[model samples]
Target: MSIKMMPYLILDGNGAEAVAFYVKALGAEVMALQTFGGMPQSPDQPVPDEAKDRVANAQLSIGGAEFMLSDNYPGMAYQLGDQVSVCIITNSKEDSEALFNALADEGTIHMAFQETFWSPGYGIVTDKFGVNFQISTEA
Candidate 1:
């Protein structure tokens, strides 16, 4: 299956800052950014004040390579050195599902394979070795 992989950084309420820093340090260019407050609101899970100003997602490019990052959800625990995850973009829903299920085997499934606004298939999993992965199918 055709696929693309990119690094996803989870910062501790400093994703915007990190994005700016990386832009200058790595000569990256901002591609897109979405803040928590900009996301569609849900009555069941409202966005917290502390997270409203934080980044929900940010995409960048450095030397033609895609880079992405986001802030930890409000009230979520933050641990140093565990901020990075691998994001895999597959060409088909089947490829996304297969990879996610394979990684979730003997591991943890953070989010079961499901459809999302951005893709037909998406999920999050942390493998047995504790390596987190974000799987998504191209739109």
Candidate 2:
């Protein structure tokens, strides 16, 4: 048996934009993008028109690693700086720094990318969409 974990981000109505930004910043590939309107709905539980275009789910791959994301459920409350953070282990220092800087463009940097005790480079940032990230070079 094998076990794997994939982090799922729930953006506050900005999931699609976040996915697009990640594609450019982290060089991630969009595996799938499904909107709420595309999902099958029951007549008794119709989806609201305002949410029809919101992201229901999206799958993205960065290098060989993958993760999923979606817009927050209709009335669910979401707060930034939560306990979860997506960590990326890069192949080289340049890759790690580049990704860290890209994510810091309009985001808050909790830690700047630099030589760390455990790795050649490491940093943490919370992207514009409020998703936290930890970028590091392989140890």
TM-score of each: 0.93, 0.57
| Candidate 2 lDDT tens digits, 1-139 | 1223467677888888999899999999999998988887869979998889899768899999898788866876577746356877777888888888999999999788988655798897989988888787867
lDDT of 2 at 78: 75
Per residue, candidate 1 scores C-alpha lDDT tens digits across 111-134 of: 899998778999999999999999
Where does candidate 1 have its weakest 10-residue lDDT segment? 73-82
Q: Distance from true position, residue 89, model 2, in Å? A: 21
Q: How many backbone clashes does candidate 2 have?
A: 0
Top model number, TM-score: 1
* Model 2, TM vs. native: 0.57
Q: How many pairs collide in each candidate, listed in order?
A: 0, 0
Q: Model 2, which residues run further than 4 Å from truth?
A: 83-139
User: Model 1, stretches more than 4 Å misplaced?
Assistant: none
